[model samples]
Target: MKDPIATMKSFNRQFQLGKPEIEAVEWAWPQEQGETMFHIINVYTKAAQFPRLTAESGYRLQRVGGMILGMVN
Candidate 1:
């Protein structure tokens, strides 16, 4: 199985969109001092094999609520 982290990196390196599109890959993690924390996951790239690559990777985290919410390539 392939690694999700490595795959994400590779996908990012291979895919090339406009500057605005490329900027969407950034993620923001919340930092709450006393309350709770939140993280926003946003990925933008053009990889047709992304789904298949992730599927074969046995990514259990995806089922546990970690979502690939926004994808624009």
Candidate 2:
């Protein structure tokens, strides 16, 4: 993704439409070892929705060479 933030924002907007399961979407780009990291946080209302969200997000990110570090509560 040439513009990771923009890409994610677009994805978030599309994903959140009519989806009460998701509360919020946040992201951060922190520099680590001279490389920028893309971190995404999806706040969801239902625990059951987490896996699907995570999987979809991971899949999208992976297409741009991004990886999920892990999930945090």
Candidate 3:
């Protein structure tokens, strides 16, 4: 996808890489020892997409499967 920030894994990788734009991260609760922890990473618009996106630019999710990330204006 043109906007790498459009997906959960990509955004998580960004967070692991210390991307400053990551606003916050949400982790699945009820953590169990040795169990995989799921995450929901929140971030603002992609730097490359910020300029091109607009209130009128129209919202579009590159994908519709799984737990899709949410968008805000």
Best by TM-score: 2
| Residue 13, candidate 1: C-alpha displacement in angstroms | 1.1
Model 2: lDDT of residue 12: 50
Which candidate gets the maximum lDDT versus the true structure?
Answer: 2
Q: Evaluate all candidate structures by whole-model CA lDDT and list the values in order.
A: 0.30, 0.35, 0.27
Instruction: Write the residue-wise lDDT of candidate 1 on 10-42 in tens digits.
Output: 544554333333233322111211111112222
Write model 3 residue lDDT over 1-73, tens digit each, in one string: 3333245446445334223222221121112112211222112222213333343221221121112343321
For residues 1-73, could you state the per-residue lDDT of candidate 2 as single tens digits? Answer: 3565565455556554324222213312332111222334322222223344556554443333222223222
Global local distance difference test of model 1: 0.30
- C-alpha positional error of residue 16 in candidate 2 after TM-score superposition, expressed in Å: 1.3
Top-down TM-score ranking: 2, 1, 3
**Which residue pairs in candidate 2 collide?**
none
